[model samples]
Target: MALSFLSHCLIGLCALSLFAWAEKECRYLPGDSGWPSIDDWSGLNDTVQGRLIATIPQASVCNSLPYGNYNSTACAELRASWTEAETYVTRPAEMMNPYYQNQSCDPFVTEKPCELGNYAVYSVNVTGQEDVLAAIRFAKEKNVRLVIKSTGHDYNGKSTGKGALSLWMHSLKTLQIIQAYESDTYSGPAVKIGPGIIAGEAYEALANVGYRIVGGECASVALAGGYTSGGGHSMLNTAYGMAADGALEWEIVTAQGEYLVATPQENADLYWALSGGGGGTYGVVLSMTTKIHPDGFISSGALQFTLAGAPNESSFWEAVRLFFEQMPSLVSDRNSLQLEIENNTFDVFGITLPDQNISAVQPLVAPYLEELTRLNISYTFTTNFSATYLDYFASIMGPLPYGPYPPTEIWNNRLVPRSVVLNSTANNLLIDAFKLAVADGTFLVGCNGINVADNEQRKHPDNAVFPAWRDAIASCSLTAFWDFDAALEVNLAVKETLVSVYTPAIEAATPGSGVYLNEIDPWYEGDWKQEMYGVNYHRLLDIKHKYDPDSLFYGHFAVGSDEFTVDGSGRLCKI
Candidate 1:
């Protein structure tokens, strides 16, 4: 009897030990005993039909010693193309922000050793749902960190992860136009875009069918991924609606590795969360079908002025004040304006007015133009009319330089409520905040009066897009940049200035407002859950727990991300 009891105690102790070992907080990392073996990865590659690729730092071709693929000619070509947005989008594991890349492999730094610092160690070139499923399952079973990437145009470093297995959705280029998509709530032309389809490709494809869709102004942004998932805004937002407002259905693979179609009538909660809650959080999006509009002419106007052209500093500010004052009226006319303010320079890249003639903008900008003339400020203004929205977009806002120019750039933005623009006191305060931001860094402001609240009926009433956006008249972004070789402290100071000084100033101007999730400061100091998702955050959290209870899908500042933290070694661990 004594021997039997001792044996039972030993067995129980062993069972407890195994249980404790299985519940380790951190995910398996390379060189860890629990990490997937060669045979395991080989099986996954076979499952994905040999699409698995060992990650090579994009700049590896520029380095000589570490990666060994270096060639002087290829390095030169890479250095030239590094500034182009297309260069990063085509390469798996290449992100727009080099800051997240940890300056591991810089094309310009040939002497430095190229390493896969924060980039994924391996990636599955996802071709379809099967590939996504295989990768998700493998990561779940192996307890490895997994991340998803599409076009790699993320501003907040959500697409790239350190020591992670990546699902590179860039290859899933499937595009189909629905001539007449009919549903209980929506009846219109729609487009089914694969997760990989970028804005430029979608625009061209839709234009060929004499239609257009509301997508990101930056042509390289993937239409189906983070762009739409984080409440995509476009030049056509005032006339139509935000990208989330057009989402009719989403075909996604949840964290449970179950394939599901989420629409208003079925899996409605999933649909709402996936619409604007955030991307790379709730599930892996396979494709999205969004409403498309008929092709229509767009009138574009451009304006430019510098301090040298102004009578005085005071006069220049007055002109800027007048421009902000006129925003409401212009937005009421269904116009969208993209403004860039740096030091003493103010450039209106374009004021896009859909379905209007070039003459339509004359009255809209008369007040600001008159103010410029009254101040004796010399300015240049031009207007052009395009045959279609696609024509105007392609001409003005096609692929531009992304990053690694200044090397690192961070952004913090606010959705300026319409009420603030209408109130004189608030408007001046808002402009003061803008001036302060410009005094510190750069501000790329998008002015529009989109009625997302009214337009919600076009798709569904409830979605996860921040409620503040529904009442916003403009989106103001504060940007800061640093050199590639800048020290960590310098980068932190730049981000801290935006967080402490600029963000608070803007937030004070637009009280109770929120920021665009897709283009937010990664280290936002405010209540990020509220700022990004607003009143819908709790509901979104519930949905997140329902779908991804294990917290398998984690991105920086993404929903449910608060539950986990990435340690110094970059292993994601439950807090």
Candidate 2:
């Protein structure tokens, strides 16, 4: 009876896979193309499902609407040019890629400013690998722009675009517990991740096998594309490395529309690039294969803090800094800890220590406790509790509410060096700055630090679409939640340290530095060639020109942007 039931389920899955593999039938024969059989000059006018799918602009109706970025006349002109073969149609690829301009709200404090472009770009719901291959081929043949989006977590708007047709890969998430065809005792079962996989889901999937992939520490961040593409950071990073380091293989849809599998043995250059080259510098990533670690070590809990009611603020900052300094020795490679500061009035810090046992954490944090007590500061730190990935994730983050939950609105981020907090004077200034923000009743803070050593342990993946970081230890982001009116001013004030330190480091470095592609500011523009990509830029360009001669893919950090690069005067230009 059991065998029969299992067989029945297998048959059902086969049928489902078949249905998903079918493609939209083409009604017209594209000239010199293998799609349809017929060939004739007049056939150009013939209507076909292929043409309908390929020719429609990702934002066909955007030009006719009242968008925040354009005046009525300019919008109309932009629309008119798309329907014709004028200068606008000939314009450099990058200009028309965004679903909505990412930087549109940079100078504004709107509630939606935390979000980037909408689902206004491509409207694709692809199911199989063939669909991705076809999308790539179709864009190449039709002279339409192309970009891929999975979770749309990208901050600089690297996912969807207007001139660009969307190749949505989020449907590819197929979580599985499969031991590779050949494996030894050490190999263990691997988690099969799809392009749309998020850290939250991957954790759940791996939990089934008593294991978890060291990916996506951010609850809402996607693991396969967005986070991995930008060298994803996580609570486990202090012990492991960045997310890219764990990637074993990837099924990528290239510029030439070929669906290729990249691994250490095949397409090695692409393998290197995607690990951390930053997004939009290479082909659209389909899915990744990553490392699976033994699960059940996660220690999750939240602690709250308040300065207004507390007797001392300086003591609080010192204790916090001191705790981080001691954090390295207390935890090993298997543990994870995330600290979230809610506000000066009250702060909730969540710690997920995946490497150490629960009993060990209390002892490790004891020194800070004593110091806090000595300074006459009142505080509460939870006893570490062992929990399953699913339970921990659910309890810690809660459910996603309607219209995108506003509380965990830490939508985007950039990696700041620990030096900024530990070594640089920035740490000293940061305490006062955070204190001031809280004193003024304007700041609610959540800080997440991922130990990224495991991510950079091996040679970094230097291709595909991510930036490379050198032996990076952690990625910290500060999110300030505020009322609609106060959001802009508050964020600007919080960003002062970033503007003064991290931003200048990037531009001032003989070569600039790079933040995660998923966390860049829309208003942030730069050559970024050396800083973001290091040595991978030139190689990525060569691949871009080879497979995308007409340069059809141009959304969310389009490649070959030579024509639209920012000039010496910060003027937007066409090369």
Native-vs-model 1 lDDT? Answer: 0.82
Colliding pairs, model 1: none
TM-score of each: 0.92, 0.68
What would the per-residue lDDT of candidate 1 be over residues 1-575, giving only the tens digit for each residue?
99999999999999988765754667888887788999999999999889999988778888886767988888888877676777878888888785686667888666788988788889999988888889888988898889999987776778888778999998888998888999888888999998888888888888888998998777788889999989988887877778987899999999898899999899999999988888999999989999999998998889999889998888887777778777777776467888877768888888888888888888778877888888899999998989988788877775332212232457778898888878889988998888887873344444443545464323335678888887888887777664555665777777788889888998998998888988887778989888888788889889999999888898888988889888888778888
lDDT of 2: 0.50
Give me the displacement of residue 504 in model 2, in angstroms.
5.9
Among these predictions, the greatest lDDT belongs to 1
TM-score of 2: 0.68
Which regions of candidate 1 fall more than 4 Å away from where they truly are? Answer: 1-23, 110-112, 399-408, 440-460, 485-489
Q: Candidate 2 lDDT, tens digit per residue, 355-398?
A: 45676667656776676677677777776465665556556554
